[model samples]
Target: MREFMVELTTAVPEGTDPAEVDRRRAAEAVRAGELAEQGRLFRLWRPVGEVRSVGIWRADDESDLRSNVLGSLPLWPWMTAAVTPLQPHPNDPGPTG
Candidate 1:
């Protein structure tokens, strides 16, 4: 199988706040079902950036990725998110341990 990099940017769905309750709820959902089966969550930090969270994902393909997001994340139906397919590069630095 091939490897890919997925960048998922999530918005705190309207009344949701990324700092307090929302993050906790999300973390719960991650623990309850998602993280074990589908995602590795390579990066999650709040030091400083354009986005609040950043994760590096590994999957079999696009469909697998979708199955993961829709199945795991407790995001609202109207929540906004973006997923990008990263190109493979010998020198890409990519996601590291």
Candidate 2:
């Protein structure tokens, strides 16, 4: 598996119904939990005062990350994401250190 750092930002379309946005948010939370349980989603965070999020994700490859993971996001249509693959450093101390 490969790890990726994903940065995402969401925008609620102007003039959209607030209730509908709320509903989407609820669904997003549910999907997030499911992904976490499946071990695809490693960690998530929100940038303070910004409509942005960061996630550490594990996937078999970039295609899986794009299709099964990002594509499956409920709010994907309204979001923009940047993905960066991570590689381990040889000299860094690991858990055993």
Highest TM-score against the true fold, candidate:
2
TM-score of each: 0.51, 0.89
lDDT of 1 by residue, 26-81 (tens): 66566535553544443344437665344555566767656764345655243443
Clashes of each: 0, 0
**How high a TM-score does candidate 2 get?**
0.89
Query: Over the stretch 1-97, how does candidate 2's per-residue lDDT look in tens digits?
Result: 8999999899889998999999989999999999999999989999888779999998999899989898898898998889999999898696663
- For lDDT, the strongest prediction is 2
RMSD of each: 4.7, 2.0
Question: Stretches of candidate 1 above 4 Å error?
Answer: 1-29, 32-39, 45-51, 76-78, 92-97
lDDT of all predictions, in order shown? Answer: 0.52, 0.91
- lDDT for position 36 in model 2: 95
Summed over model 2, clashes come to 0
